[model samples]
Target: VDTFFGDTISMVVIMTCCVVGIIVNVFILVIGYLDWATRKKLPNCYMIVSCLSSSRLLLQGTVLYSTLCQGTHHWNVLRVQSALLVLSSTACLWFAACLSAFYCVKIATFTQRHFLLMKLRISGMVPYLLLGSMLVSLISSVPFIWTDFSVHLCNSTRSSVKNTTGDSTVGNISYFKVFILYLTWMTIPLLFFTASSTLLIASLWRHTKQMRRNMTGFKDLSTQVHSNAIKTLISFLVLYFCSFVAEILLGIPSCLAKSRWKHSICSFIVAVCPSIHSILLIFFNVRLKQTFKGILLSMRGRILSPFVLSFVLIIN
Candidate 1:
């Protein structure tokens, strides 16, 4: 009874995070679409944001579905769901790395000939990079069709099977393969993300120092931009690191995998990363921030108008 209650509470928390993430991501997509419809052109950065949000949306939905269907005996259902989850999660990281690379090329004060040349071509390369990310994610997820998550589930639920050496050996080998594949895909984007983000942050810090030397005010526009960008990059770095840790925890074959509550906690960590990061993106983006504020004011006005009218009628 106690275990069931704990599992229920964990599921609630996971569901809440997933649902909130889905809503935020949907808002980002809608805003991106509306902006494109009005301006007839979406910038490369905006395009990347939209793609990231889309992947997060898919990932959150898959997580919700996986949580809901955790008890079903259908291995095929679990197989496809796991594949979709991995594909979306991989795409999320790749898109994030692309976004980081884009910001680095666009904003960082790099003067090398190669850096300048890459900057000139980066806009043209965005579509190709995005396409490559999708292809990679798809390729990484396809191997899941042959993998059986049910085997792990069964082992976790049964104690007698746990003592079998042959089964443990087979399970270890299978888990190692999955871990290797997941780590391979994860590491590719992580490398790009780390390099680009570090470069951007370093460049911005130098620029900020130069601005200070010029007797610029703390509130100077350039200084503010640099500061905000640094903050965003740092926050993203932390979230990415957390996501990496969570993925490692999930991928590793260990006793933690057998614990229902521990698994749920890891899932929550994974789910919260994209959601919180999306909110950060919205706050850091001027256009999105303005639009979001306008939305809130409009909502507040609507909610209060009826009360104001009722008070006016009473006075009359």
Candidate 2:
């Protein structure tokens, strides 16, 4: 009964993540598309964000399908599904890292020559950076395919009873390989994200100090932009840190301590991160926020219009 209850809770959490993630990512994509349709060209940051949203949508869909398959005992396709999940997740993370770096370069006031050069080139380099990230993600997913193949081959060669020890050995090796892959793929992006956010925060701090010294009683447009940028970066950093810790906990065998509940909670957290972060992005971005508000207002008006008309008619 306890096991059944745990499984039910896990399923509920996974489904919620999938549903919310799909909705949020779809909304992001719609906003991106509408922005592009109106302007005819998206800025580099928005372009990357669109890509991130698409990747996240794919990831969520895959997770949803994978979860359903697990319950239905249709495990045959999970190998490919796992590979796709890894690919999508990698793309999502790298795009987010690129977005952070872009914001840091564009918003931070730095006197360094390298910083200036980066600021100048970032817009033009975004496409190539995204392409490179895709290639890296593809490379990272290749090992998963190999692992799947190796496991299949091993299983084919021996009977289940005879291969118990060999299966255990292969499982251990697979886990180690996955752990290494996670570390390798995640480390550079995590470092880049941390560095960019730190630089932006430091720049904001220095600028605030300067404004105080100058006694600028009124905030300028530039100051407001810096303040907004700081808020956005800090919010993303917090979400990223939480998701990163959850991912690390899920990846490390020792960390789980054979606790199914811990594993389930971490899985749910990982699944929910993209959705939560995307919602935060919408709130922080001016255009997206306005667009969201317009949508809400329109929805409210539509829902209330008929009732309002009926009430007015009765009053008359």
Candidate 3:
């Protein structure tokens, strides 16, 4: 009964997260598209963010499908699922890292010639970088097509005639392959994200300190901009760390501990990260925030206007 109840709760949470993630990512894509349409050109940051949101949408969809179709033994299904998982996860992380790098390059002020060159070239480089990331994601996912994940199954009954040595060898090889794949797919992107975020934070911190030293009690526009940027980055860092830790935990076999509930809980947390972070992004971005606010106000007025008119009529 306890296990059943826990599983029920886990299912509810996971489904809710998956639904929310899909909705938020879709909204992000729509907003990005609308902005691009209006401006006649998409900025590098917006482009990267749209790609990230799209990848996250696919990732959440994959998670939802996997959860719903658990325990299926079809090779083709498993292969497709594994491939999609790798592709989406890699793309999501890579795009997020690219977004971080874009932010750092655009917002950070440096006197170095190389820094100036990077700032000047970043827009031109964005499309190529995105292409490279997609290629890398595809390459990383290709291995899943040929790899046999059956060795990881906890319940495999072997007859006495079965070749134990061969089985052990295959299992060892599979484990090694998965380890390398995880390292390549997860660790590298994480390092890139960390490095970019650190650089941005350091740059912001230095600028904030310099501003404090130069200015008095008066808060200037530059200081305000710096403060807002720092706050946004800090918020992103917090959410990124939470999502990263959750994903790492989900990937680690020992963390699951043979408990479906534990796995479901981790998956739920992972699914929530993308949606929550996207919402945070919308809130932090000035144009998106204002647009969202306007929509809400319009909606409220529409809903209340009828009631207000009816009340006025009654008074008359």
Candidate 4:
């Protein structure tokens, strides 16, 4: 009973967090679309962030469904759910990597000819890169269609399946192959994300140091931008690392069989990662932050107006 209650509480928490994450991503999408409608163009970085949010929204929805159906014995449904999660997560990682690359090119000062050329052409290339990411993610997810989720789950739960059938060994081998393939796909984008973020940080640090030595140590616009970008990248790195580790741990069959509560914690981390990062993105973006503040103020006003009117009527 205690175990069941704890699992129930974990599910509730996961569901609530997923709901909040979905709302945050929706707000990001709405804000991005409104800006694009008004201006006829969304900035490249914002475009990437918007795409990331959309992917994360899908991820959160998948997580919510998976949580609600945690006890589901339907292998086909679990297979589809796993496929969708991989697809959405791959897209999110690719988009985030692209965002980091975009930031590096636009803000990092490098005098190399190749770097300068890339900076010049990156804006025009962003659309193609995003489309390519989607295509790649779709291809990566296609393998899941053939996966035997029953065997996978059986192995994960460490049941004595081999005693019943020789096919269990073959199934395990196939599952391991697919798992490695998926990990490779995920790792590629992570490499890009880490490299680009690291390069940007190094460039910013050097530039800031030079500025500090030349100037009177007052924070100028460039310095402020440098500081903010570094902070955002650092936060992103930490969150991304946590999610990556959680994903790996969750994927391991041994890890899953060892401690069920650890699985819940990893799920919570994965579900919350995109939402927390999106919140940080909003905080860093001036337009989004201002718009969010305005919305909150308007909501507060609406909530208070009726109470104020009731108080006035009572006094009169």
Candidate 5:
């Protein structure tokens, strides 16, 4: 086996990615936490942000650890760190599913109870259920701690222990099994989400049509409501599509000649997913910019206050 130098250009790029991921996701968490405070009622927007932030926190933590270890000699903590990375990745996937389900149920049920359920108490529980289910499912990854990887690189980076063609027969099977688990998780919940959201949109369309027929006045609102529902559905659909691509990449053949290339591509998707999700949220939800502004102001205040106070004390 030819030992390539320990440091590589790929490592540098991946570390840079980790830093960016950490920065973006941390901002998301801060903004989400702050926005959550301002909400007297838990709108679907609140649940979306909360669940997305929960997923990104785990992602950011894993990236931080990876970044810290970058460029260092391969340490022996791969088994433990790899397990943690998997757990974090799994948490992100489950939370995403939970988010979709939350919105599906939240909107679907809202159609029935819109008059009375527009209040705080009922709406707030939607996010709790999403986050709670994600936590429980992610905890199931604890058994990964005992399994050993022959190399000391993180799971996403590790190509596996190769013998003949630089690929492991056993490792490929293991990854295939994990990929199946991810597929099942993504498939089942999103199936329900797609079905429920379809029904919601259909029902909304019909109701909005009826309203349009009845209204002798400003008639754009019915159309506007239908448009908003379409936008909301599109946002959720994009998220699912992105995740679906990622899942398919995970199941790719490990023994292929382009296996390393595939791994590199998959890493980018896994790394950038949260940021992409953030951009989608910002695009679809106008309130996102407001929350972002508040978060930025809060950060700026924290950063500058110490310096400002120190300068004032010296002058006085």
Candidate 6:
């Protein structure tokens, strides 16, 4: 896999991925927030959407800092992940779980108590909760960030450097705590997400089947919207599932043993999913695709000479 421009290509891809992920997720958040604001009285669904978008997007920063800041000791905290990624990811889980619960109640119980619904909506509270969780995550990761891990300024090859894990005992404990959080917070919630969504889908399937052939009218539109929302959520879930696997493949072994290359590869992979989602959304999303095409057209002057020359070269 290591070839000419290997590291260069990988770094570019990683950085590009971060940039795209941040942009797309931020775009999603902005859309969600705009939707919430447009309706004056924010609905529970919009609130949950806003929360999910913001939390997922914020993860872009965590991954970005972690990926770009590699091969360093001083600012190892953001690069390495501590409480930041964990807590943010966890909060995302809670928010999604809330969404799932809201849907379940909406579908099953079918409530119409508008006043009670207003009180139940958590959009207003999301910002404070996010801010608090973020602070906790960052503060907790300090110990996890390799302090003594330093490299000589003379070395041109940054990846070849090693992390000088400072104070073995404290580091070990930090790692253990991270492990616990992984089990209790990250892994558990991921599993919960799968289970809860699975159950909801199953129930929905049974209900639809009971109602005979197919759905129509406003019920159909409502069902379609719900399905669309679920599909979007599924996208996030699939990405996170892959992330969990990558975390194991890249993180566990090194945390248990001592291998920098493996850890480095793992770190790179960790940042991949968020970026992948961004690129997919930008390229495939109808609106985003149109916008991207517009930008390309606007910049066609700069791109054309090189493009035409490359085309001529290929033809010749």
The better-scoring model by TM-score among 1 and 3 is: 1
lDDT of each: 0.81, 0.74, 0.75, 0.82, 0.55, 0.55
**Comparing 3 and 6 by TM-score, which wins?**
3
State how far residue 221 of model 1 sits from its true place (Å). Answer: 1.2
Better of 1 and 6 by lDDT: 1
Using lDDT as the yardstick, the better of models 1 and 3 is 1
Q: Which ten contiguous residues of candidate 4 have the minimum total lDDT?
A: 164-173
Query: Against the true structure, what is every candidate's RMSD?
Result: 6.0, 6.5, 6.3, 5.8, 8.8, 7.7
lDDT, model 6: 0.55
lDDT for model 5, on a 0 to 1 scale?
0.55
The true-versus-predicted C-alpha distance at residue 108 of model 1, in Å, is 0.4
The TM-score values for the models, in the order shown, are 0.88, 0.83, 0.84, 0.89, 0.62, 0.63
Q: Which parts of model 3 have CA positions greater than 4 angstroms off?
A: 156-175, 253-256, 301-316
Which stretches in model 6 have alpha-carbon errors above 4 Å? Answer: 1-4, 35-41, 75-81, 108-174, 211-219, 253-269, 275-316
The per-candidate count of clashes, in order, stands at 0, 0, 0, 0, 0, 4
Better of 2 and 6 by lDDT: 2
Q: What ranking emerges by TM-score with the best candidate at the front?
A: 4, 1, 3, 2, 6, 5
Error in Å for residue 145 of model 4: 0.9
Q: Write one digit per residue (lDDT tens) for candidate 2, span 226-276.
A: 887788778778877777787677656532345667667877877888788
Clashing pairs in 3: none
Please, what are the lDDT tens digits per residue for candidate 6 over residues 1-316?
4653666666676666667767767775665566568777655565565666576676667766766765444334533454567655566665655665555445532335862474366456555544554554455445445422222211343342344445232232334445554555556556766775665576566766754565443366545545654565567568767766766554352324354455556656667775665454444344445555554556555748567555434423
Candidate 5 per-residue lDDT over residues 1-316, each given as its tens digit: 2223323545556566666666666665666666667765455656656666666666656655664574332323533555566556555655555555544454443435552353334466666766665765565454444432333123344464433333232232244455456456546555665765676676666767777678878757546645654676666666666755764564454443345555555555666666666555554555665555444455546767776555434423
| Residue clash pairs of candidate 1 | none
Put down candidate 3 lDDT per residue, 82-107, tens digits, no spaces.
78877898898888788888888888
| Model 4, residue 220: C-alpha shift (Å) | 0.8
Judged by lDDT, which candidate is best? 4
lDDT of 4 by residue, 206-266 (tens): 9978886889746688778877777888888899989888887777664245778778999
The true-structure Cα RMSD of candidate 3 reads: 6.3
